[model samples]
Every structure is written in C-alpha cells, then in structure tokens.
Target: MNILQLNFEAGWRGGERQTMLSMLQFREEGHTVHLLCRAGSQIGERARAAGFVVHERKGSGGVIGFLALSGKRYDILHVQTGHMLTWAVLTKLLHRTLVVYSRRVAFRLKGALTRFKYRKTDLVVAISEACANSVQALGIQHVPIIADAVLPVSPNATRSQMLAGQLGIGQRKVVATTSALAADKDPLMLVDAIAALKKRRNDFVFVHFGAGALEPEVRARVAALQLQDTFLFAGYQQNVEALFGLFDVFVMSSREEGLGSSVLDAFSARVPVASTSAGGLKELLADDRGLMSAPGDAGGLARNIGQLLDAPDWLGAMTSKAAEYFERTHRLDTMADAYLVMFEQLLNERRRPRTAAIATAPAATPGIAVESHNQA
Candidate 1:
C-alpha cells in the first residue's frame, strides 16, 4: 500500500523512533511509505537514512499544509492527533481519504471541537490499551489498541563496551532511561531515586539518555540531592537502543507517556524495567513482569529501583518475560498486518473512485465503538 504518515514532532524522540521503525518496516515489506515532517528535522534525516521518502510539513497551520499534501491519491492517510484533525476532516470530505488516528498519548482530550474532529476520523490506532481508552472516552468510535513494535534488528555493540572508560559504569549494572529532558519526563526523579539507592547499595549508576530543555535543572537537582557522583546525562544518542546492553534495568520517571518506546528497546536487549504507573506503564506492565511506582513520587520510584537492584534473579526473570511479551504480541509484522486490514476495510466503503485502486476513504462500520482501550 502507498501510505502517508504525518507527524508533528521534529526531534527524534521515542514517538519518532516508533514512527521511523514502522515506516522502515513497511519499506522492508516492499510498501511505499512516505513520511511528512518538519524540514531538515532529525526525523527527516533518520527517515532518509533508512531509505524512505521524507517530505517537509510547512505553513503556519499543519492542517492546511497536510490537506494540500493529501492530494496525490494515496492509499491511506495515517495521522497523529491535535490541530491536524481539521485536515483529516477536510481530507475525508474532499478527497474521501481514510483517516487513521494514531493516539500516542493516553490523556483524555476535552472540548466539543476536539470530539467532533475524532468523529470525522475513520479509525483510531493507539500505542497501548490505556491510550485507546482515552480515544473512546472522547466518544470516538472504531478505536483499536495496537501495542508499539520495534522493527527487528541484529544486536549491536553494548554501550558499556562503547563508553566503558568515561561513564565509570562497569557496563554490567547500569540503569538507564532514554527520554528527552522535558519537564514532564522528570529526569531528576530518576537521579534522586538512584541517590536514595546509594544509601543501601553502590552496585549501579544511573543514565538519562536524551537531551532536552531541563538539563540545567536536572544537573542542579542532582547536585542538590548529592547524587553528582552517580548520575550521567548521556545526551541525545541515535544508537540509544544499543545502550540497553550497558544497563541491567530500564528506568522511567515520566509524568506522562503514551507508551514508552524506550522500554521496548530495553526489553529487546533483555533488560529489566522499573517505571511509574503513568500513562501506558500500568497497561504495559500489567502481568507483574515489571515494577510500577506511583506517579511523581520520588520515594516510591526509589523503592522500585532498589527492589530490582537487590533481586538480580527476579529482575532477570522479568526481563525475559518482557522480551517474551514483546516478541509474542508486538511484532512489527503484526502492526503492519493490522494496518493493511484497516486500509482494505476502508477502501471497501470508499464512494469516490481515485486514480489508484488502493485508495481508501474514511468510513467506519456502524456500532463498532471499541471499549477495551481502557484496559491496562
């Protein structure tokens, strides 16, 4: 299928990682996948590197820019949420394009305008069950909870062997979190959590892998908490997935997450995970395979970290389970196959004929409102 994916984020964060990997997978399967992103963005660079067509999304309003881009008789319009919904509605009205909303965030959206935009969409694809629920709560029908998948790649060198000299980490007991230094990510919480761990143990060091706006505050927080000796801000590294080998456990301190793409990286490397029950964490770790702390509670986060550090065997088991869970339920083929089915379904309801037989239009099967999106 000739698919067009529109994303608003320019930087290569977790969400961008998911999008890139998915597009690459489609290309590997011989599908024509084009990515619409900001000009000269990290996403554009990465997409081009992976051999996918990367176009710039221009204009003050993304809705206008996206609608103009939608005119080339594509098979499906895979879009992310926000003001772009206006474009999706217009595309559905004018070009009869199928709208697949990928709900990457789990927070409930307010206002009637937002609700109406969702109604105009044909299907909603969420990264996790938690996010799917948020779509349904807004009265959006035909919501499907599709867990995020990582396109399989051969294991690369571990970060420990790559940076063994500078990090002061032995390459065995490193606990890492790959998130942007945004205020909402709470990188300092992970620092403080590790600091609290030092009172009882000294076997591990913490690394926050992504760079963002809160770097100075995070450094100050580490100094204030006297955790300067242990915490490392690894900055933004494209080979972040490779770093999973350096860490024994993956740590998350997100105030909110649609679903953590980094956690999947850790799992792929067979690393255990400890996270707050924020956003999709509760749903992702529901089988008790991972530890979950209360959101925004540094003390609770600290306790969760300590649990994984002390019980190496238990943590190992959890890591294996996480890897197993991902391999079984979140394969890239499964994600792509589901999308293929949705596109085929949408094309059947298409009224206006396009130049391409593959062109699919927005049309939802009646009374098919999905409710399990709230499952976590």
Candidate 2:
C-alpha cells in the first residue's frame, strides 16, 4: 500500500510520536509511506532520520503544493492533526484517494467548517473512546476507536543515574510526568500537587519532561511556591521511555487528554501511574491499573500520589496490572495490524461499484450538514 501522512504540527508532541510510529510500522510491513510535515519541524527531521521519504513544507499552502504535485500517487492520505484536516478534505475532493483522519483530541466539533471537514472524511479514527464519542456527537458516524501504542524499552540504569546526577535528584524518589506545560496540561495544578505533597514528605522530587508556552508560568509558580528544590523542569527529553523506567511513579495532571500515551509509556516501563480522570484516561487507568483524581484538583492528585508512595505493595500490584495490560493491548505490531486491516477494508469497499456513490456526491460546503452516515 502507498500512503501519504499529513501532520502540520511543528512540535514533537504525542500526536507526532504516534505519526512516526505508524509511518515506521507501515514501512516495516513493506508499504511505501511518506510524511508531509512542517519544514524544520521535529517530526519531519525525525522521520527523515528514520530513512522515510519526508516532504517538508510550510502550511496549508504547502499541503496544496504537495497535492498538486504528487497527491494522486498515493492510495490513502492519513491526516494526523486538525490544522491539516481542511487540506485533507480538499485533497479528497480532487483525488480518488481515501482520506483518513486520526482524531487525537476530545474537543467537540462545533464550527460549521470543522463539521463539514470531518463529514467529508472517508474514515475518522479516534485515539480513544472519549474522542470517538466526541466525533460521533458531531454527526460523523464512521468514527472508530484505535488506541495509540507505545514502544516498550528496557530500563537504562546508566542513563537513569546520569539523569539523576544532572538533575540533582540524588537518592530522591522520582515522580515524573511527560507533557507540554500548557493550559490544557494543567502544569500549575501539578506544581500545586507537588507543593501539597511536599508538606507531607520531602523525599520525592517532581520531574517534568516537556516544554510549551506555559513553561515560564509553570517555572514562576514552582519558584513562588518554593518548590524549586522539589520540582525540576527537565524540559523536553526524547528518550521518555527510559526516564519512565527510572521513575518511582508517573503522574498526569492534564485537564483533558485523548488517551494519555505517556501513561502507556509508564505502563510499558512498568511504573505505576497517578493521573487525572480526564477524557480517555479513565479508560486506560481502569481495573486498578493506576490511581485517578478529578481534573484540576491538586488535592486529589496529591492524595492519589500519596496512596502510591505510601504503599509499596499496592504500587507493585498496580504496576504489575499495568504491565499486563500494556503487554496485552498496547503492542506496536497490534496497532499496526489494526490500522492495516482498516486500510484494506476501506480500499476493498472503495473498489465496489455500489460504494462509488461517495464519489458522485456533491462537494461538501461549509454550511452543508453532510450526513456522513450514507458512507458510514
């Protein structure tokens, strides 16, 4: 199969990581995959380094250029971000290629433009059930839930020791989280939780492994709360799985999340998770795999973390369960196989004369409430 993946994000967030994983897996399965990403972006650079054919372009205009140049060469166009959804819709109108969108956020599609773009998509793959529900509510009946996968890593004790020395977290229990310090991530709430946890115990240190617009604000709050000693904004680290293996516990304080792939990374590393019950996190942390708290509640987050810290036996049980869950459901090959199956089904359906009605339909417009159930 020939595939063209579109992602306009300039940062290396969870979505970008998943995009890379899918592209690499497809290539490994003897499929030709190409990535169209922002010029000089981390995803583009990484994809190129991984020996994939990468087209680096600027914005929606770049997307148009790519489609005009080589869009017809691919069988499928997989769009991985919202910024590129409109471009994908336009491409679908211009080509026979099936346009598949992966919805990574749980935000509702309210705008007419947003709804129209999604309605015209051939398939909408939600990264979590919460995200699928949100998409279905917007009248897109073809939404399917395909959870993201994480690559398991062996614990790198040497790297952990080096990181500990560099961060000055010697002999301290590490409570780590990997998230962009943004409003949605609620980094301030994490800081507050760390502050509250400090009041009870000072033996643990909080480490964050991401950067965002809210970095300065988070740092200022950490200082204001006198948590400079307890909190270490380790910035963005590429080998997060290695760091997860070193962590005593992984905490997620996001106000909203699609599925919390970082939590999956923690599970892959056999670390217990303490996260806010935001979006699909509730689903991932189910069955006593981890402890959860309400979103934006620092007190609850602290209490959950305390439960893990105060009980080693309970933590071991949770980590063991998480590891089992990861082994069962989060394998890279399993995710790749599921996607390939969906791709084959869509392609086979497209080959049917009866399904050609989708191509004969009127072009989607901003105001038209296209009832996608016809194609669904």
Candidate 3:
C-alpha cells in the first residue's frame, strides 16, 4: 500500500514525532509512504534524513501549496492538524481519495461557516476519549479514538545525550518538560512550579524543550519568578528522544492537549511523569501510573512536582508501572497495525456496494480490516 501523511507543523513536537513514526513504520512494512511537508521546513529535512520520501510544497496559510501534491496516488492521506481541515477538504474534492482527519486537541465548534469548511474528511480519528468528546460536542458524530505513540522508548542517540549533558548546568538534577511553549501548554505554570521548588531544593535543574510564540513571555515569567539560573530554556532540540532518559522527573502542565505526545515520550523514556488533569494527560497517567495536578494551577502543579522530587522511593515504582503499561498498550507495532486495519477497513467495507464509493468495482482484501486502527 502507498500512504501519504500530512503534518502542518513547523516545529517538532509529539505530533510531528508520531507522524514520523507512523510513516516510517508503514514504510518498514513494505509500503511506500510519502510525506507532504512545508517547503524549506525542518521536518521535511528530517523526513529525508530518516530515509522517507518528502514532497515539499508551499506550507504557510497564505500560499497553501501542499494542494499540488494532493492528487498524487495514495491509499490514505492522514492529516493530524485541525487547522489543515479546510485544505484537507479541498484536496478531497480534487483527489476523491480517503482523507482521515486525526483530531488531537479539544476545542469547541467554530462558527457555522468554519465548521462547514472542514467537515468533509472521510474519517475523524481522535487520540483520546476527552478529545473524542470534544469532537462529538462540536456536532461531529463519527469520531474514533486511536490513542498516541511514544517514539524512542529509550534514548539511543548517544550524541544527543552527550549534548544534553553539555547544555546549561552540567550534571545538576534535571526536571524537564517538552512542549512548544504555546499558551494552552501552560509552560508558565511549570516554570512557577519549578521556581517554588527552587526555594527548598535549588540544586535541582529545570529544563523545557521546544519554542513558540510564547517565547518572550515564558522567558519573562522565568525572570519574574527569579529562576533564571535554575530554569533553562532548551529551544526545540531534535535530540530530545535521547536526552529524555537523563531526566529525574518529566512533567507537563498543559491546559489542553489532543493527546500528550511529549508525555508519552517521557513515559517511553522511563522517567516518572507529573502532569495535570488536562485534556489527555489522564490517559497517560490513569489510575496512579503518574501524578496529576489541576489545570492552570501553578501552586497545585508545584505541589505535584515537589511530591515527586521529595519522594524518591516511589519514583522507581511509578516508572516501572508506566513502562509496563506502555509496552503492553502503546507499542509502536500495535499502533501501526491498528492504522493499517482502519485503512483496510475503509477499503473493505464496500463489499456490497451499499454506498456510492462502492457503486463501482469493490476491491477486496481478505483479513485486512479485522485489526485495530491505532498507530500510537
């Protein structure tokens, strides 16, 4: 099968990492997977580096150039961003191919006009139950939950790990979070939490990865909290998968998340996590696999961080349980099989020609649609 995956991310994050993992897994299974990425984009380059074919097209909203590659033959065009919905719908009209829209964030329905513009995706794959609820609340009734994946369970990039050690204070205790510094991610809350902890245990290191519009404000908050020395801003490093294993505790304080990919990465890295009860955070730490805080509460977040920092005995058990859950439920191969099943199901369901898509010749693939459609 030939698959085309589209990701409209400029900076790397959990979503982008998941997209790459999915595409690469499909390719390793003997399918030709192509990536449609922004021209001059870092992801496009990384895709090529990973040995996947990338078709560079115009990416910014003003130009919307990925349209040119939409007509190319593909078994599935999987889109992971809601902002790209309009373009995905537009591409559907021209290509007449299956468009699977993967919803990752929880947002209210836009006004009628915007809603109508993006509802044409053939299928909507939500990453978590919370996200599915948000979609259904928006009047979309056909959402499916596929969960999320953790790329690079253990840090293999030796060079990347060495670089992380060299970054900022060498060998100080590191408590890190990975995010794009976006408003919904609530980076400031993490900063505040770490700062408060600094008063008691200033020796611990606090680091955050990724960059976004909130850069200045995040920095300002660090200064405001007087944690400039303790909190280190490690902007968008490609080697996070390698560096994550070095952290003592991984944390995320997002106000909203479609599915927390970075959090999954943290789990895969086997570092215990401290997160909030935000959109998809609970999915990762359900029933005491990890600690959770109330959304947008810095003090509450601080307390959670302090609990893990203060209680060294329980950290090992927490990570052990998390690693067990990840291996059993979130394996990459299982995720790939799930997606293949979904694509094959969409392909096989037309056996009786019940819908217009089946009025023509009904292609048959035995035993293909019986598997799960979850590419973590």
Candidate 4:
C-alpha cells in the first residue's frame, strides 16, 4: 500500500512517535510510506534518518493542494495532527483520497467546521477508548479505538547510573515523570505532591523530564516551595527510555491526558506507575498495575505515592503485572497490525459500488441525519 502520513507538528511528541513507529512498521512490511511534515521538524529529520521519503513543507495549505493537483495518488492519507486534518479534508473533497484522521486528544468537537471535517474522514482512529467515547459524545460516529504503541525499553544501567550521578541522587529512591511542563500536565501539582512526600520521608527525589511553556512557572513554584534539592528538572532528553532504568517509580500528574504514553513506557520498563486518572489513563492503569488519584488533587496523589512507596512487595507485584499487561496489549507490532487492518477495511469499503446519485450527494452536516458505517 502507498501510505502518505501527514504530521505538521514541529516537536516530537507522542503523536509524532506513533506516526514514526507506524511508518517504520509499514516499510518493514514492504509498504510504500511517505511522510509530509513541517520543514526542519524533529519528526521529519528522524523519518529521513530512518530512510523514509519525507516531503518537507512550510505549511499544510499549498502542499496538500499540490499533491492533489500533481496526480500523485496514495492508497491511504493518514493525518496525525489537527492542522493536517483540514488539509486532508480538502484533499478528500478535491481528489476523493482515502483520508484517515488519528484523534489522540480527548477534546470534544464543538464547532461545525470541526464536526464537518471529522464526518468527511474515511476513518477516525482514536488512541484510546476515552478518546473514541469523546468523539461519539460529540455525535461523530465511525471512530475506532486503536491504542498507541509502546516500544520495548532496553535498560541501560550505565546510562541510569550516569543520570543519577548527574542529578546528585545517589542511593535515593527516584520518582520520575516524563511530560511536557505545561498547565495540562499539572507540573505544579507534582511539586506539591513532592513537598508532601518530603514531609513524610526525605529518602526519595523527584526528577521531571521534558520542557514546555510552563517551565518558568513550574520552576518558580518549585523554588518557592524550597524543593530545589529534592526536585530535579532534567529538561528534555532525546533518549527518554534509557533514563527509565533510573526510575524506581514513574508518575503522571497530568490534569488532562489522552492515554498517558509515558505510563506505557513505565510499564515497558517494569516500573510501578502512579498517575492521575485522567482521560484514558484509567483504561491503561487498571487491575492493580498502578495507583491513581483524581486530577489536580495533590493531596490524593501524595497519599497514593506514599502508600506505594511504603509497600515494596506491592510495588513489585504491580510492576510485574504492568509489564505483563503492556507486553500482551501495547506492543509496537500489535498496534501497527491493527492500523494495517483498519487501512485495509477502509480501502475495501471505498471500493464498494454506490449508486451514482447517492455517491454524488453533497457532504452533509455531521451529527444531524447522516449515518456512518464504521461505528464501534
């Protein structure tokens, strides 16, 4: 299959990571995969490094039009970002290309334009059941829940030791979190939890990875709370999996989340997780694999962390269960296979015969009268 993957995001986040994984898997399976991403974006650079054909564009506007006008057809046009989804809709309207939109966020589609775009997509791939449910709640049907893949983490003890030494956390229990330091991530709540944990036990240190717009604010709160020594902001590291070896426990303090891919990473590393039950996190961290607290509740989070830390045997059991669950359900190959199946089903549906009058009908306003065929 000739697949054109579009991700206009400049940064390499979870969505971009999933796109890369899908492209790599498709290529390995002898499918022709092409990437269209923002010029000089980390995703573009990495895709090129991985030997995939990458088309760099300044924006999604003219490039998508150019592709449609140039008569370069793709079997599937998979859009991985919201901006790209608009372009995909345009391309579909002009060329009837099979467009698939991956909905990774749990936000509802509020406006007519957003709803119209989703309705026109050949398939909607939601990264979690919560995301799919949110789409359904918005009255957009035909959404399928395809959870994001988590690559296996090969522990590097030397790298972990080096990271520990650099952070000055010798022999200290490390409660690590990898997330963008933003309001949605609730880094301040994490600082509050760290403060609460410190009052009870000072043997542990908190290390946060990743940078974002709220870094200054998070830093101010950390400093104001006098947690400079206890809380270490490691900034953004490219190879995050290597550092997972250093974590005795992983925490996700997001006020809102999609599926919490970092929690999946923690599972891959066989580390116990403590996360806010935000969005699809409740789906991933079930069955005693992790402890959960309500979003933005620092006290609740602190209590959960303290309880987990106090029980080493329970932590070990959760870690084992999490690893087993991740292996069974969230492997990279399994996710890729599921996507391939969806792609095939969409392509087959497109090939079915339709009455000329029905086929030529104008795109209707979504969530009104039109019924979608691929609803779960």
- Ranking of all predicted structures according to lDDT, beginning with the best and ending with the worst: 2, 4, 3, 1
Between the candidate structures 3 and 4, which one is better when assessed by lDDT? Answer: 4
Q: Return the number of clashes found in candidate 2.
A: 0
Per-candidate total of colliding backbone pairs? 1, 0, 8, 0
Query: Over all chains combined, what TM-score does candidate 1 have?
Result: 0.87
**In model 1, what lDDT does residue 23 have?**
79
Task: Determine which window of 10 residues in candidate 2 has minimal summed lDDT.
Answer: 367-376
Per-residue lDDT of model 4, residues 149-169, tens digit only? 878998889988888899899
Better of 2 and 3 by lDDT: 2
Worst 10 residues of 3 by lDDT: 367-376
Best by TM-score: 2
Q: Which candidate number has the best lDDT?
A: 2
- Which structure is stronger by lDDT: 2 or 4? 2
Choose 1 or 2, whichever is better by lDDT.
2
TM-score of 3: 0.86
- Name the candidate, 1 or 3, with the larger lDDT value: 3
lDDT of 3 by residue, 34-128 (tens): 88777776778889998888877665453244553544467677886665666767656666567787777876666875567546667788889
Reference-based lDDT, each prediction: 0.74, 0.86, 0.76, 0.85
Model 4, runs deviating above 4 Å:
70-72, 354-376
* Clashes by residue pair, model 4: none
